[model samples]
Target chain A: MADAVIAAIPPGRHARLIVPRLLQRGEDFTARLLIQHPMETGFRRDDTGKVLPANVIENVVLLFNDELVFRGRVLNALSANPSLSVQLTAQKSGTLSAHWRDQMGNVGSISTEVRVAGA
Target chain B: MPKHAQRRTLLGAVAAAPWWWAAFVGTASAQSSTAGSDALDERVRAAVLVRGGLSLDIPVIVETGTSVPIVLFADPSQLRPGVRVTRLGIIAPKNPRPVALDMELGALMSQARIATNIRLGASQSVTGVALLSDGTVWQQSIAVVLTGSACYDGT
Candidate 1:
């Protein structure tokens, strides 16, 4: 993973969402997401001996077809390059979207479509 | 004293040592567990918490503390029928912030199974708590040993 390249990307562009493209109604499936971040804790110092400010994702929300499904509040205790997985039931064919905001006021979002058959 | 009498005294003392050790260590751990739960209670704002409804899956021994993968599962058998889990949280009592991750599960969730990674400052027991729609709270803790300390020193 190139840290420089990831940093250069605009906020929310570094987010990755992985979900099954096809699904059967009423079946349980897992949706995984990863957001690239340094997750600074403010206790760390840079090479020049200056203390680094804490910068981490503060809020994360996941929605399916505009219906809220999950929301998360992350603290500095989470590891860098935070990733999360949750089990969701296939209801109707719709969009699965993830949005997050960092401590520094940077926001990012990503979405994927899942088709549910027999719905 | 007779030789047999002296031998009997030595054997009795040896047999009692384990019980003594257990009593001493048991009290220490019990106190720590209480403190851990108290911290969690404050974070979740719940008065009473029932243990054993949730399970935490993590390595007993981790080579590094930077990224420790953990999975939390809600036991349906332990929960009341028709009561859904509304929230799930991970608490690291020894870390700077006790609440590592707090998540709200909506109606779309079929089950409460969540996976994530966390940072530990040292070897300590981490707690996982779940809140049910019926206003009941459940929690479970797991001890982890970290050979390499993380999050304490400046990054």
Candidate 2:
């Protein structure tokens, strides 16, 4: 079931991350992450009445400078094209990255530079 | 019996029924909905939950349950020195799987907050549970009414 879902996704961008280009040290800011996927609940049926296998993202992890910041488990109950926003503090300049895996075992990751001034 | 006395008796009966109160009264009364999920129950049982240190932000009424946005925020003042929130969970009582989202936080997080969208199968109460590093759990619940369902298979 997982293999079929992975095959359905088109080749291209699978995720996007939005972070401020610049930040002040010791300041808190919101980082938004959006993933492109159907997030199928497996409870829905196709036009011909076939049950859609659950193909939602299973886990998400956010990291800063190689340090884990936030991790989450995604379930079928989340809406399709899932978007997550988390609050993070700027302690120093580093790299902010996000990685996620779907129930189908497909992995997607994206990273951005976090520039903090006066660190 | 007199007409006024009969009316009073009917009102009293409605107020006296436990189920009626659970259905109408909001907040704590709607906790019974959490019973549908064993994961939620086990977490609640394992922690020391204090009602109201967290706040849930979601509309009281929504036209569709397809993508209802919600935000969970924990009071920073409630945390003692050297203690921080380490985990968070979101539970929708009426969904096929009541446990919607589970998250773990690390030290880099300046605030105990998160925003996301979720699917709701019906108009029901949603609960947010946060676990702190000091073994304290803060919980908050909000009721949401959906005019249309989101998870119906047949559509």
Interface CA RMSD, all predictions: 5.6, 4.4
Candidate 2 lDDT tens digits, B6-36: 9998886554432212221222223346544
Q: For residues B7-29, what per-residue lDDT tens digits would candidate 1 score against the true structure?
A: 99988755533222222223324
Best candidate according to lDDT? 2
Error of 2 at A30 (Å): 0.7
Residue-level lDDT of model 1, residues A1-119, one tens digit each, is: 69997667754458788988789888889999898887887777887878888888888899998887888754457788888898888878889999888888889999998889977
lDDT of 2 by residue, A1-119 (tens): 99999887742248888888899988889999998888888888898888888888887899998898888753557788889899998889888999888877878899988889976
The DockQ for candidate 2, computed on C-alphas, is: 0.41
Alpha-carbon TM-score of each model against the true structure: 0.79, 0.79
Give the C-alpha miss distance for residue B93 in model 1, angstroms: 0.8
Error of 1 at A11 (Å): 5.5
**Which pairs of residues collide in candidate 1?**
A12-A108, A44-B155
